[model samples]
Target chain A: MILAIDVGGTKLAAGLVTPDGHVLETRVAATPQDADAERLWKALEELIAPMPEAEGVGVGCGGPMIWPDGRVSPLNIPGWRDFPLRERLAASFPGRTVRVHNDAVCLAAAEHWLGAGRGHANMLGMVVSTGVGGGLVLGGRLVNGGTGNAGHIGHVVVEPGGPLCGCGGRGCLEAVARGPALVAWAQEQGWSPGHGPLDGGPYEEGRAVTGRGLASDALRGDPVARAAMARAGRALGLAIASATHLCDLDVVTVGGGLSQAGAPLFGPLEEALRAHARMDFARRLRVVPAALGQSAGLVGAAALILAGDRYWDAI
Target chain B: MILAIDVGGTKLAAGLVTPDGHVLETRVAATPQDADAERLWKALEELIAPMPEAEGVGVGCGGPMIWPDGRVSPLNIPGWRDFPLRERLAASFPGRTVRVHNDAVCLAAAEHWLGAGRGHANMLGMVVSTGVGGGLVLGGRLVNGGTGNAGHIGHVVVEPGGPLCGCGGRGCLEAVARGPALVAWAQEQGWSPGHGPLDGGPYEEGRAVTGRGLASDALRGDPVARAAMARAGRALGLAIASATHLCDLDVVTVGGGLSQAGAPLFGPLEEALRAHARMDFARRLRVVPAALGQSAGLVGAAALILAGDRYWDAI
Candidate 1:
């Protein structure tokens, strides 16, 4: 048995899974605010306390983290700055082994093992949510770069001089296509979920507007909302086209809340991809929806310990 | 002993090398024009005739080719469309191994084995010349995606709506930063090599205006030439920034004739890279000059067989 933990800014989740990719039981809780490392650690402990007797543990979280040292400084989790996650997890688990990887990589491992990327040898698994994240598998091997961060696809500079990204870059795929970016664009175009643009409301972080809300509005034929989703898809398509041209991908599978936009998201995406992709092989690349949905990260974290080198082809 | 052959549109070269990457013998000849496949095969036969007894042969050529069948259809070599290069080469030397790969991949293999990429595990090798070419090594493994064309960095669409490329894509790095692209940009800015644009004696193909010629003018303090090179560097830097962000590369090595422009090219490139790279680790990426110049391809081809899985880890 394997204990898998999925750490996110908004939520924390844990799962007990079998070796063959089955999730037996799962636990979830809201992540704590920036209080202290102890508070975050306590939250994780609570999430993992009920995990069944497992021989190994696997954890996946937002990055700007180190793999070897197992120290994490996720952008959203301020309390986790250089937190020795692996050491603590390993110590808590006693004799069992503990492993950690970027949440996006875990998603790729899950997809490659049992999700939409199952049959493909070279694939890119992406999460287009609050921010875009990705992982790659090439030649049937997980592509971990020198420092285990080989698949930061969201950060690929598509427009070079356009919108400033949250990560301090210009025109990143995430900046143009992720949920926050879409909501920002929609609001800039004089659209709002509330009564009007001047409506008074507190800036509730991570919930001021959601991709699902915008997507529903777009489905309802709201022009402003439709335009934002269309523009987001276009930006995503151009970025994916560049990646396909360079990586010769077999397929690209996208997940996360933003992906719930479905046809409204994928249609314009495929169109932009067709416009930018050049060569015959590159044009053959496909973009599709991910199968596992939210459970992907948890299952993939389990894979890091259970699937072994089959998913973790490189350090 | 290893028999290495480097095939380019303009030239074909062969070499006999030891197991330690030492070239013992070499032969060179200009590539034949619009001739039959047999004519091209004959030229290859002559080039390899004197390659001392070897156990294995490695051939590197331009791509848009099939890896499994070893069929080649390089854009410049119009007559040898889908030529059966591996079959013929195998038949010529029975009971011996012959491997074929893209020339850019070969350059990467050679560099990883004995040149600039020696110590780095995850590296990207780029040839910024007449047309851009690239190869990737991640986690100490050569990357060959679906069709063995994973590292086509030159074609990445950095500027989505900028210029038309030879491959029908707009704003491709090759379209905005290659030798011809730089020359074209300089010409557009009212700089001439010999006489007026209409006074050209003939369309000399790859020799219309070379990167070396532009570099000389730039070094001679011509503002137009300087701006062209600067623009080319910025384009290349943006493309490489995208690549570095995605691949999580440790280093990138630039080769080809244009690389000889030195500071004039590298200065702008480094600046642009610093401008676009956002993540802390991505910002740490370093761009350096390729160590082995012209012979890099031949050496890398030999490495395909000689270095075994060390150089050909992925494909």
Candidate 2:
């Protein structure tokens, strides 16, 4: 069995997974964003301590990580600047093998092994949650570029002249179609979220806010919500289409709360992709929902440890 | 000795290169665009007839090729639609090895083996000629995606809202910065070719349309020509920056006729890349002119054939 841990901005998940892809046990805890490295270590140890015997441990983290040093410096988590995560995990679970990779990359591994992308040779697995992130599995191998940051499809330019992205680029796919941006865009258009004359109803505060509210509204004949969703879908399709063209992925699996909007997103996304892609090969690429859910990161991390030698052997 | 052949829309170049990297002999011929498969075979045979004994033959042609099938359909050459190049080469040069690859991909291999990318682990080789094209060397291996169409970076979206590309996409990097597009842009702006407003005389046709003309005009301080060249440079740079972010290339070795424009293109190209790539990691990427000149295609194609077994084993 492998102990898998997923470290996100909001939460931490620890799972004990078996060789045949079974999650024997799992735990979840809210992450203490302000905590120092030591505090985070203690939190992780607590979760690992209670788990049954495992052969190894694996970690999946956010962006800007150093694989050689096993250190991380995620923008969302302020305290982890140059944090030595591998050493901490080693200390916490002595005598156990440990490996680390990006969360999206891990998710892609999981999908390739057991989810929607099973048996697919070239695939891109994406999570469109708080911020967009993804992993690429090409020719049945995970694509971690020089810095282990290959699949930053979120940063792919959607609108070169559009809104400013958090990475300081203009009109990234993340900036225009991510959850928070969707809410902000709705608010900018005077669609009140339980606030004023423009208030259609109580809308959530993320892109999911628009997705959940808009899907029903569109179904019930609300033009504004339908238009908003259509815009998001088109932008998503454009970005996905570009990625498909560039990477030659056979399939793209999308996950996250925002993707739960289902056909509201996938329908127009497909249409927009068809409009943008160049050849028949690119146009035939498939876009599907991620089969693995909240536990995908955990499963992927565990896979990293289980397939450690081979994983490292690949570029 | 290795025989290298580079086939383009208008020209066919064949060379007898020694194992030590010297071109001992060469043959240049105008392409037979209207030829059938048999005639095309005859042309290749005619070119190779004058060359010294060769160990292998390497071919570089336009893409969307099926390598395993040994066939190609070049867009620029109408008669080459699904041409069985590999079969013909194998039949004609029986017992001698023959391998074919996309021209830009071959150029990338050339640079990696003996040119600007000699010491790099990750490199992107680009060709800016009548059309823009690209080749990738990632993790020290040329990436020929499932269909041998991996590095079609020219089709990558650069200006999301710019021009209509021949590929049916709007604002592809190729559509905006390709040679014909640059000339078209200059003509649309009424920028007549010459050393000055009236001194250098009336605009000529084919000669003035070359990269050399652009360089001469830029040297002569022609504002409109300089602007057009700068625009092309900036577009190319932006695309390279985005590619750097995506693939983490150590160097970008540029070849092709337009790259011969030299510093006039490189200066503005570097400036635009640095300005657009907002991140530190993304900004550290380097862009340099290809060192292998025109022979890169032959060398790269030879490398592909030589590394065939190893390449197949990797993926």
Candidate 3:
């Protein structure tokens, strides 16, 4: 069995996974937003304490980390800037092997190993929730680039001089298409969550103006919400087309909140992708929804130990 | 020793190279335009007939070909669509190894092995001539994608709804920044080659309006020509920034005609790259002119045999 941990800005999850990737036991806890590094460590320890003994431990954490050594400083998780994640895990696990990688990269591993990207030798697995991120599987293996941030498609410039990105760039794919960004754009266009055409009474009260709310509203035929989805989708298509052409990709699997908007999002995405991805080899590419859901990060973390040959090459 | 061949739309070249990438002998001839496939093959045979025998032969040819098997159908070379290049070479040289790959990929290998990209583990080598093309080296090896067209950066979309490309896409890097495209844009902007501010008498008379002429004009303070250079340079920068972020690239080496425009091209390129490649990891990337000159393809083809461990893997 492998101990798999997923560390995100909003939550911490730990799972005991079998050699074949099945999660036998799991634990979860809300991340302390303003906690100190030690406090964050304690929360993770408590979350994993109930898990059974395992042959190895694998972790999927947020990025800008020192790969292999695994010192993390995720943008959203301000509490753990440059935290020694891999060192702490190694010290705690003793003789067991410890592996750490970016959560987005883990998602790619899971999809390529057993989900949407399965059987595809060249695939890009993406997430479009709070932030747009991705992992690349090329020639049937993970592409661990110079800094282990190979498939960071979110930062790819989709619209030059369009919008300023959190990374300090203008018009990054993430700036235009990330969940929060899309919701913010919708709100700017006068979209209020519970004030949509389908919103009726008490059930819609106190609903947060989240990407989920925007997706729901779009599904209910809200004009501004649908437009928001279309805008995000077109940006995604442009970035994916660029990636497909540059990498000669075969398939793209999109996950995360905005992707669940279905046709309202995918329709524009498909149209833009077909329009932009015009190369002969690129024409063979297919973009689809990611099959693995919320547990994808844990499953992919487990893959670090169970299928190291393809996913875990950093160490 | 190795026999290296470079096939392109305008010219065919053959060289005898030592194991260390030195071109010991070379022969070049203009490609027989409008000729049949067999006639083209005869021209290639005559070009290499005088060269000494070698242990192996390697070739770098224009792309849109079936890799490894090397059936070439280069878009610019209409005489030989899907011509069996590898088969013909193998038959011509029995008991010897013959390898084939895209010419741009060869340039990448050459740069990585012996030119500007030397010592860089992750690099992108680009050519910005009549048509833009590129090859990627990641983790110190060539990235041969699903269809063996991994690093074709020409088709990467830099502008949304910008310009129509020969590939039927709008805003492709090639469409906006390739030699002919940039030259055409300059002409459309009322800048005629040899009619620039510095053009004088017979020295500039009858000069063809080409990418080179435009570059010369730009260097001599031609406003429209400079604008065209800046336009192409900015597009190159955007595409390179996108590529750097996506691949976590360490360096980019640009070759070909337009790259020789020097400051008129590189200044805007550097500025735009900094504007978009804002990620901490991506900040370290360096863009430079390719070190090898006209013989890059020949040297890279030689590397296929001389440095097979890093450059040749298909067969």
Candidate 4:
């Protein structure tokens, strides 16, 4: 069995996974947003402490992190800048193998290993949530780049002069297509959260505007919401087209919250991808929703140890 | 020693190369513009007929070919569509090995093996000639995608809704930055051939407008020509930034005819790259002119056999 840990800005999760990738036991907790490095470490430790003994430990944490050594400083987790994550994990789980990688990369691993990207030798697995990120699997193995940040598609410039990205660039795919960014764009176009059919009832009063709200509104035929989804979708398509041409990809699996928007998002995405991905080889690519869902991060974290030959190369 | 062959739209070249990548002997011929497949083959046969025998043969040919099998149907070469190139070579050199790959991929392999991209584990080697194309080396090995067409960056969309490309796409990097495209754009902006100081003499009469002429004019202080180079440079930078973010690249080497434009192209390229490659890791990337000159394609073909461990993996 392997102890798999998934650390995100919103939550911390741990699981005991069998070698074949089944999760036998799991634990979860809301992440303390204001926690210091030690406190965050303690939260992770407590989350996994009750799990049965395992042969090794694998972790999927948010980036930007130093790979192989695994010092993390996720953008959303302000309290854990440059935290010595892998070192602490190693100290806590002495004598057991420990592997740490970016959560997006982990999500990609799960998709490639057992979900949408399965059987595809050249695939790009992506997530479009609070941020848009990805991991690449090429030649049937993970492409760990110069610094283990190989498939970071979020920063790919999709719009030349459209919007400023959080990474300090203008017109990044993430800036245009991330969940919150879509919701914000919708709101700018005069969309109100409670105006849609799904949010008109008393139970939904005072609900905050969110990407989920925008998706629901788009499904209910809200023009502004649909336009916002289309905008995000187009951005995603352009970036995917660029990636497809550059990598000669076969399959592209998209996951995370916004992907659940279904037709509203995917419709425009397919159209834009078809328009931009014009090369013969690029035309052969398939873009689909990721199959592993919410537990993908945990499964991918476990894959680091269980399927080390393909997913894990860093010591 | 290895026999290396380079097939391009305008020319065909073959060389005898030492194990360390030195070209010991070479032969070149202008490709027949309207020859049939058999005639083209005969021309190639005649070109290399005088070469000394070698243990194996490696070839770099213009693409859209069936890789490993080496059936070629290059876009510029209308004479050969799906020609059985590898099979013919194998038949001609019976007991010896023959390998074939895209010419752009060969240039990348050459750069990685012996030129500017040396010592870099993750690099993108590109050519901006009549067409814009590239090859990628990741984790110190060539990344051959599902169709063995990995690193064909010409089709990467850089300008959405900008210009129509030959591949039936709008706003492709090739459409914006390739030599002919840039020349066309410059001409449309009221620039004419033979107007620059370098082309004023009698010997330069009747010379067509070319990317080289535009670069020369830009260096000699022509506004339209400078703007054209800047446009191409910016497009290149945007594509490079996207590639760097997606692949976590360390070094980018730009080669081919237009690359000789020097500061007129590279100045804007660097500025745009710095503007868009804003990620902390991406900012670490270095974009430089390709070190190898016109012989890069031949050298890279040789590397397919001489450094097969890093460049050639297909059967």
* Models sorted by DockQ, best on top: 4, 3, 1, 2
Chain A TM-score for predicted structure 3: 0.95
Determine which window of 10 residues in candidate 3 chain B has minimal summed lDDT. Answer: B195-204
* Candidate 3, superposed: residue stretches over 4 Å from native: A194-207, B195-207
Give lDDT tens digits, candidate 3, residues A132-199. 99999988889888889889999999888888899999999999998788888888899888543233
lDDT of 3 by residue, B99-171 (tens): 9999999999999999999999899999998889999988888888888898879999998988999999999
- Please name the candidate that would achieve the greatest DockQ relative to the true structure: 4
Clashing pairs in 3: none
**If scored against the real structure, what TM-score would every candidate get?**
0.94, 0.91, 0.96, 0.96
Report lDDT per candidate. Answer: 0.84, 0.74, 0.89, 0.89
lDDT tens digits, residues A231-313, model 4?
Answer: 98999998999999999899999998778678999999999999998889899999999999668999999999999999987
Q: Mark the regions of model 2 whose C-alpha exceeds 4 Å error after superposition.
A: A192-222, A309-315, B195-205, B307-315
Task: Judge the docking of candidate 1 as incorrect, acceptable, medium or high.
Answer: medium
Candidate 4 chain A lowest-lDDT run of ten: A194-203
Between the candidate structures 1 and 2, which one is better when assessed by lDDT? Answer: 1
Candidate number with greatest TM-score = 4
User: What is the Å distance of residue B204 in model 2 from its true position?
Assistant: 8.9
Q: What range of 10 consecutive residues in model 1 chain B has the weakest lDDT sum?
A: B194-203
lDDT of 1 by residue, A1-315 (tens): 899999989889998888888888888898998659999999898788877478999988889788766799988889889999999998899999898899988998899889999889889888888889899888776787777887888988877888999888898898888887788789989878632112222335555477766766676667898788789888888888889878889999988776766777888999988988888889788798899956888899998888777666543
Badly placed stretches (over 4 Å) of model 1 are A194-208, A313-315, B194-208, B313-315
DockQ scores of all models, one per candidate: 0.76, 0.48, 0.82, 0.84
How is the predicted docking of candidate 4 categorized under the CAPRI scheme?
high
Taking the tens digit of each residue's C-alpha lDDT, what string does model 4 give over B53-165? Answer: 88889999999999889999988789999999999988888898889999999999999999999999999999998899999999899989988999978888888998999
Per-model interface RMSD values are: 1.0, 1.8, 0.7, 0.8
